[model samples]
Target: MDVLLVEDDKWLGQAIEIGLTERDFQITWVRSGAAAIGELQRQEYQLLILDLGLPDIDGQRVLQSVRRKQLALPVMILTARDETDQVVQALDSGADDYVTKPFDLNELAARLRALYRRRGGHASAEIQVGSLRLNVNSHEVWVADDPVRLSRREFDLLQLLVSQQRRVFSREQLERQLHHDETPLESNALEVHIHNLRKKLKHKDWIETIRGIGYRFSCD
Candidate 1:
C-alpha cells in the first residue's frame, strides 16, 4: 500500500520507514505537515500516518484539512501522546485509528492492513475477483488454484486494479499508485509492470490497454 508518513523526528521517521518498507509498504516520508498536505493533494495514497508533533503546523490542523477536502483516505494517528482527551479529539477529527509511540512494528503493520481493507469495503483480507484470488494480509496471489509469485510493485498494481475491477485507470493514476516521490522510475516502468502482470497471470486480455487513454482490469 502507498502510505504517507508525516513525522518530524528524523530517527523515528527513518526507523518507521525502514520497518514498513521491509513489510512491503510503499512509504513516502515527510517531516512537516505542509509537505504531507501537499503530497496528499498531488498523489493518491491508501493510508496516512500522521504524528501530532510537527515543526510547521499541528498535525490536527492537517487532519482537519484532509477531512475538509472530503478525501476518503484512511488516516492513522501516530504520536507520543496517549491522553484520553487527545485520543478522543483525534478520532473526532476523523482519524480511523490511533497508535502511540513505542509501538510494535508488527502491530502497526497489521493495523494498517485492517484500515486498508475496511477502506476498500472488504470485510476480510482476501479479495477474489473471478479466478484470481489475492490475500491482502499475506500478500499472496493465485490464479485458479495455482500460486503466482509477484514482485512487490506487481502485487500492489494488481491489487489496485482488481479490487476496483472495470474502472479505467489513467497511466498517471496507476503510476502514482505504484511509485512515490523518493523513488525514481524509468519512463516505461509502468508498462513493464503491466506487461509482466499479464504474462504472469497467463491472460493477456485481463488487463486491457485503452490506446491513448490507459488500462483497466477487464474480466469480460
Candidate 2:
C-alpha cells in the first residue's frame, strides 16, 4: 500500500514512516500542506496522514482542496487539535479518520486499515488469488499449497499484478504501484522481474505479456 504522510514534526514524521514501511507499506513523507497537495496530485496514494497545522497552507485548506478534486483515496487527520468542532468539521469535510497528536503509531495504523476496509479497499492482511495466497502483512507469497520465496521487489510487483488480475497494466503503471521514483525505469526492469517470478513460480505462462502493450496476469 502507498501512503502520503504530511507531518511537520520531523521526529514524528520519520517515526510513522518507518513504522508503516516495516509493515510493507510505501510512504512518501512531506512537511507542509502545500507539498502534500502537490504530491497527492501527482501520485496515487491509498491513504493520506495529514496534519492540520501546516507551515505554508493550512492542512484544513489542503483537505478542502483535496475533497474538491474528488479522488477516491482516503485521508486521515493527524493533528494536535482535538477540539470537538474541529473534529466534526474535519469529518464533515471528507476526513476519513481523526488522530490527535501524541497518538500511538499502532492506533494510526489500525485506523488506516479500518479506513481501507470501510472503503472496500484492500485489506491489511492476506488476500487470495486462485490457488496462490499473498500475506501482505508478512510479505509472504504462497503458490498452491506450498510456500514460495520471492525477493522483496518481486513480491511487491507480483502483489500488484495478482491483486488486479483482469487489468492490463503498463510498465509505468506497475512502477507507480511499486512506488519507485517518478523517473522512468529501465526498459528491462519489468521484464526482469517477470522472468524471476516465472522461474520461482515454475509457471512461465501464467503471466501474459501483451505484445507492444504491457503485461497482464491471466490464468489462461
Among these predictions, the greatest lDDT belongs to 1
Where does model 1 exceed 4 Å of error?
125-220
Ten residues in a row with the worst lDDT in model 2? 176-185
| Deviation from native of the Cα of residue 151 in model 2, angstroms | 53
Which residue pairs collide in model 2, if any? none
16-134 per-residue lDDT for model 1 (tens digits): 99999999999999999999999999998889999998999999999999989846899999999999999999999999999998999999999999898887687788888889999
What are the Cα lDDT values of the candidates? 0.93, 0.85
Give the clash total for candidate 2.
0
Q: Which one is best on TM-score? A: 1
Model 2 global lDDT (CA atoms, 0 to 1): 0.85
- Candidate 2 lDDT over 114-151, as tens digits, reads 89786655455787877778898798888887899998
